[model samples]
Structures are given as structure tokens and as C-alpha cells.
Target: MTKQLASSAPDLPHLDLPHMGQVDDPWGGVGEGRLFTGAWVQARGGVIEVKEPATGRVLTLVGRAEAADVRAAAQAARVAQVDWAARAPTARAEVVEEAARVMGGMADTVVRWLMREAGSAGPKAQVEHQHALGFLRHAAAMGQEPQGHILASVPPRRSVAERVPLGVVGVIAPFNFPLVLALRAVAPALAAGNAVVLKPDPRTPVSGGFLIAQAFAAAGLPPGLLHVLPGGADVGQALCADPDIAMITFTGSTGAGRAVGELAGRHLKKVQLELGGKNALVILDDADIDLAARNAAWGAWLHQGQICMSTGRILVHHSLHDDLVTRLAAKARALPVGDPLDGVAIGPLIDPGQVARVDAIVQASVAAGARLVAGGTHDGRCYAPTVLAGVTPGMPAFDEEIFGPVAVVTAFADDDQAVDLANRGQYGLAAGVIGANVDRAVRLGARLRTGHLHINDQTVVAEPQAPFGGMGASGNGSRISGPANWDEFTTWRWTTVQPTAPAYPY
Candidate 1:
């Protein structure tokens, strides 16, 4: 396999991973260790060849997880969760806090691997690292937060409500923003005393799976409380259907989320879903076009526009559409797109399939009358930043989440028309409205249906302690992180007691 990590990255939170009797010195990733099933155990489903998206080069071979592995993990987590739940809240918090400390020290190593595995740009990878640290620290604080509430009861009677762990939580993560998204669920669940079975997207097992395992293990998290299984659809289905798993937290496309929601529903499991978005960035008539164009470029091209909150379409005032289009087109063509290791601003997508999908959207939008203002080309998997003008509702560029470096621009006459256009699709994930008049922008944003909105900034933003989720097709409104963790990772237990015994009404 490729050269191992040179003495860096932790193993996991209390994982018993071993190669023979010891793990490889510089842990490259979980791929270097096969699979993590309380240990570095090989999966029964055989091996998968991990490849670099930019070069399509075989990076390493990792054992592919299957349905059986998911069951075994659930069974183990169910048993281990009792002890994890029994630990002092401080004890649980310490583990997560320590993981964050360790993660901070190994920033360079993690970013390097993230670049190789997910084809992420340097700044984008660094953002993931910092955001993950925030998630861990935020989750750590949840342990010491108020656990329950004192209730007002009639004299001689006492009643109270407290949060309790859900026993076992399943996390199904996506390739884009894998580390932060997986940790957004995994860290909080652990802090709240729920054992987790994390299924990283097969394409990003290391950053989303193994890297987490390593960090927690080094921090002295108890064994069997967390298991990282890198696998395909069967494993995800098993996780949702397993009896031992009490809940599922998922982040992916709307189509995949529907499937997950359907399966979890059949089994009567609590589910938290964060799905896709075709968000809008509204440039108001009174706004500064130059500043708006800069934000649009960053939102539309950062990490190749793979982020779910990336600007899917831009709505500009008809008066300034031409000027904004000219500025955006120039910015799009200037962005360097290629290997992330070469220190470029944009990189190749996760794979060739993503490239094909991006190309199809561009071609279809142009065919439907959207003008290709700039860039409509690709070299290998690297799609040049593209700008489309005159895009409208029926065009793919306007309606679809083009998870690539492409900016689709549409124009509107007033705030009502802008809000109507933003709410045209099923996506209600995120949106942005920028203008010189902050009050007007806020008023318009308030009218929009998105779960999150920016009055003067871009759509792509995430605060670790915010109520991070969406509504409609974007999610089932099962918000995560911040105060939402208590809702997702724990169930309420209302207890009542009398001095002796309750009087029977018989």
C-alpha cells in the first residue's frame, strides 16, 4: 500500500485496533488497517481498492463492511452503552475534550490525508479540521450541561424529567464534508452517553471513520462504545433496521435520505436527517455588486461546490444582472482547479461519476437556453469553474443541486419574486440575501422558507453550536448539535414518586 502516515493521527476512542499485536507506526488511515470492529479485523465482504480522485490512482486496499458487520457492531454497542451511560458526565466530557486537544495537534497530518482522500483544497480541509474540533469541544460541554429539570408538583408528590441515552446511535455520513458531518453526530452522541456505530461513505472511510476511531482511542474512550465500519448500501440498511440501534443520524442526498427515512420508519427507529439543498444567494438591487460577486464565487466554487449549503443558484436584480455576471465570470475563470496537493483553490471531485453528473447539468442548462457566460470544459476529473447566465426555474442549473464549481445566475424584479424563486424547489436548507439595506435584507430572509439564512453573507456557513438542520426535503426537522443534541442522542424519562405508594382509584 502507499507509505503509512509518518508517526501521526490517533487510533480511536477506546478502540482495540491491532495489526498482529501492534498497529502500524504511522497510521495512514483505516484503509491501512482493513476495518475497525473493536479491533483491526477484516470484513467478510472482501476488500475495496481506495483510489485518489485527482489521479484515479489506487491508494490502498481496505476490507469492505457488510450487513453482518453492522449487526455485530450494534450488538456490541448495545451492551457497552449501559456502562458508558453509567459513567459520570464529566468522565464522558473529558474523553471528547481530550480527542479535540489531540486532533488540534495533528492538524497537518489530518489535512494532508483529507486532501488525498476527498480531494479537498487546503483551506477547505483546514476548515473541516477546525470545525470538527469545535464540534468535539461543543459535544464535550454537553456532558456538564443541565441533565434534567426540577418539576412543580402537588404537596407530598414529586415528579421530575431527565434525559437518558438512547442506548445505541447509528451515523450514516456522506463523502462531502465527511469529517465534520460525521463528528457533528458522533461526538455529541458519545458525550450524551450513547454508543455509536458510524458508517462512513465508502469513498471517505478514513476521514469519516478511521481518523475518528484513532482520535478517541488515544483519548482513552472505553472500548466497544464506538465502532467505525466503512461499507456500502447493505451496511447502511442493516444499521437502520437493526433492533439494537435505537436511532439513526444521516447526511446525504435527498433521494438517499428518503430511502433511509423509509427503512428507519419501517423499524420504528428515531431518525435525524440532513439532506440536499438547492439554496439561493439573493443580490438585492441596492447591494454592492463587487462584494456580492466575491461571496458568490467563494460559495459556488469552494471545495468544487460539493457542499450541501453551496450556492446552487444566484438571484440578482434585473438592473445589475449584466454587471454581476461579468464580474462572476472573470472570477470563475481565474480559480485554479486541479490537484489539491499542488495548492490549488479547487480540486477534482470525489470521482469520475461526479464529473459526468456535473457536465450533464451544464449541458442541459445550456440546451434549455441558459447562456454559458464562461468555462464549459474539463481536464480529467477537474471541471473548470463555469458561469451560466439567464438561468430560470425549469433549467437544470436552476432546479438541481449542481455539486460542482458552477454558478447559475437568475434575475428578479422585487423581494416577493426573489422569495418566490428561492422557495420554488423542495429544498429549504439554506439561503443568503445581500444588500446595502440590512433591514430590507433581513426582512426578505425572514420571509424565505430556509432553516438557515444569511442577511449579508454567503449560503455556505456552519457554526458548531447552532441549530444545524433544515426542513421539507432537506430534513425531517431533527436538528443536531448545540441544544439539539439532547433531543437527538437522548430520550426523556419522566419519573414520579410518592412518599409511600400511589393510591389506587379502584
Candidate 2:
């Protein structure tokens, strides 16, 4: 049996709740009890509600829309976008900038809701909230500038390319990254002058939709320009299939992403799918076992391993496999698990379903002759950080994206075998190789099929300038936060202003 550390939940730092400011709690004046009541949605005709995953607490109610309602919301956004698109680029940028400012100031407020709703721990939740705000700020500061070009001197023919928005975008955000990922989609779409109807995860509507709506409203965006549709798969599928929705930017499972793609394809609409990842972490025999173990634990357990870029698979050299697993299990056990806001090192799975999923995967893996090396039990929504060894190629744990507090360890006899084991998974999102030989690791990294690879590092670190997304089943198209992302969200239209007489039609 894995030793359970005496549940010493860390002392979370004090945070003043309802940081939405006096008399301006976007929920309603801060003193108003109505905001906490389950009436906010009814008030907005069923838009959304804030549900805490740990205790099933309801923080705020919001619009719980249906298919027709989502369609109407999209139509409303389309109509509102007509004027929004006509606004000067500077004017549009101002709204997003103001949103960024508001979001920055309200980081505590958003983090509180994120902790409550998503069961994200203190520091990571705070970081993700800040990331969301930063992305919005950076997005606001970016825009398309004319880099006009002269065409070849073929008669009077001339052409120049200029970027333009894609009208209206339908944003379907994921549960694990309720706030940050939503902003990842919404900010760029808005910055590019597209109207967006945001469909936040129903499980975390408060943090994703309600809080964001408050920021947008404070930032002075048109009321209907950033419509919030808070509902379940039905609502999301409806939004995906809606013809008026010009583009779909979604972050979720591979299965769900595929469904979104098929639907969008049927409509001939562009879809950006940031889907599932079964990332690999290769531990070379020459690497520092302690360092690799710590990094691997962090990569696998952060967000309970729910993040798309998490290293779900670890291929260790047979020479160091036993030592690494022991170190990893100890490190994982040291992580505190409790109330997300209480500054524990880790928190619960996003919801009960996620917990169940994790439990099921762990059980299935163990039954298939895999060793349950550490931390596999569940307490309500909370799942202790887990590690599995002896996981083989034929097992479901190796084949599936185990979005939970579980890391499957397998040993490789040599570098070639390690690389082959890492590449065995169907999904190729992110991978890591920890080795002393940087040159050899780099060469081996090239051979890995993942979109992004980290040599002697964790796979999930996000830099604003880094191009972030995956290949194959992980993502379609792409979404990166830098200038690359700007390029993705824009369409270059070719135009020519006659500097001289036009050519006659032949």
C-alpha cells in the first residue's frame, strides 16, 4: 500500500473575497446577496452559474442557454459585430486594453472563483489568472499594420496583402483552464476585430464566463459583442453547428475536437482545435535522477495532470528506472492536497466526473498488470497524486490520455528503445528528454513526432513569445500567443491601388 502522508493541508494565504470592488461587483453591488443566490442565470434568462467542484457550492448563477438560445446569441453577436468591425483599430484595441487592465486589477477576484470552481490550487490558479490577464493586455497592444507591397510590372497589375478579421468566432473553452484558455481564444478573436460568443465550460461558468463578462462590461465592449452562452455539450454542439458562426476555436478532448471539426466542416467554417495530448517524458540513464524525478512529478501532477501538454508517459532507461520511480513517488507524495484556496501544493480534479475518470483509468491500469506505485485513492473530488509502473504498450493507460494525477512509467533498455517507447502513443502534443548530452537529446528530440519538445526540461511552461500548439491529433491549425498567433487569426487580402492608368479588359 502506498503510504498516505498525514493529510497536512498547507495554510493558504489570506485572500479577501468579492474583490470585484464596492458597489460594482459585476455580480451586483458587492453587498447584494443576489449575486451569491442561484438567481443570476434566471435574471439573465439562464446564462450561467458558478459551481464549486470540491463542495458543489454555487457561487453565482448565469445563463444556461439552449441550442436556439446559442444561435440567437450568435446572431446577436453577428449583428453587433457589424458596428464593432467598423470601429477604428485604435478604438477596438482600447476595449481589449481596458479589459486587460480590469482583469489585472481583479486577478484576486478571478483566482478566488477559479480556486472555488475549478478546484485549482492557490499559486497555480493565481498564475493562470495572471497569464489570462497578460494575454489580453498583449493582444490589445497588437494589430495589423499595412506592409503594402508592389506587384510585378505586368502591364498595370499590382497587389498588396492586408490582414482582416474573420467576422464572428465561436469560442468553446475547456474546464481545466476555464479562464486562461478562454482568453487565449477570445482575446485574439476580439483583437482581430471579430465578434465572439464565448461558450465557457458549464462546470466553471463563473470563473470563465461571468468573471470575463464583468471585465468586458467594465472595459466598455458592446453588450452583445461578447455574448456568454453557459451550458453543456448540447449548447456547445449547437454553437459548433450554427451556420452564422464563421469560425470555431475550441480547446478540449480529441473526441470532442473531432466532433467539432466534422460539424464545422459540414458548415464549411474554419475550426481551430486544441485537443488531447498523451505527452512523453524520456529519462536518459545519464540524466540526474533527482532532478528528472522532480520535474516529471511537477509536469504530471500540475493541474492534476489535466492540462493538454502534461507528460502522461515516462520512458526511463532500465539502468535508472527503479531509482527514478522511487524518487518520483516520494516527491508526488510530498505534494499537499486540500482546499484549492488553502495553498495546498495540489487540489481536487475539476469535478466528480474527472475524479471518476481518473479512478477508472488507475483501476484499469492496475488490473492490466501495471503497478500502482503511489497515490491512487479518491476523496470526494480530490484525487491524490498517483504514479504507476510496469505500464506496458498494450495497456489502456499507455494508449489513452489519462487526464489525472497519474504518471505511467515504463523502462527502456537503450536510447533507441526509449525514443521508440515515447513515440508509441497515437497523440503527439509535447515531449521532454532529460539527458546530459544536449546535442544527442536535440537530435533525438527532432526524431520525436511531438509539435514541441523540451530537452532536460518540463513540457508545460508557457512563454508569451513561444509558439504553442501541437501536431497530429493534438491540434488542428494552431494557436500561439506571439506574432505567430496574430498571423493565424488573420486573413491577408490582396489589394492594388492604381498608381497609373488601369489595364483594359482583354
lDDT of 2 by residue, 334-430 (tens): 8878767556777878777778888998899899999988998978888888889999998888989989978789999988887888888668889
lDDT of 1 at 263: 99
Best by lDDT: 1
Regions of model 1 farther than 4 Å from truth: 1-33, 503-505
Quote model 2's TM-score: 0.89
lDDT of 2 at 77: 79
- The lDDT of each candidate is 0.87, 0.77
TM-scores of the candidates in the order shown: 0.94, 0.89
Q: Could you give candidate 1's per-residue lDDT for residues 436-502 as a string of tens digits?
A: 9999999999998898999899999898889888878899988998899998899999998888886
**Candidate with the greatest TM-score versus the true structure:** 1
Worst 10 residues of 1 by lDDT: 1-10
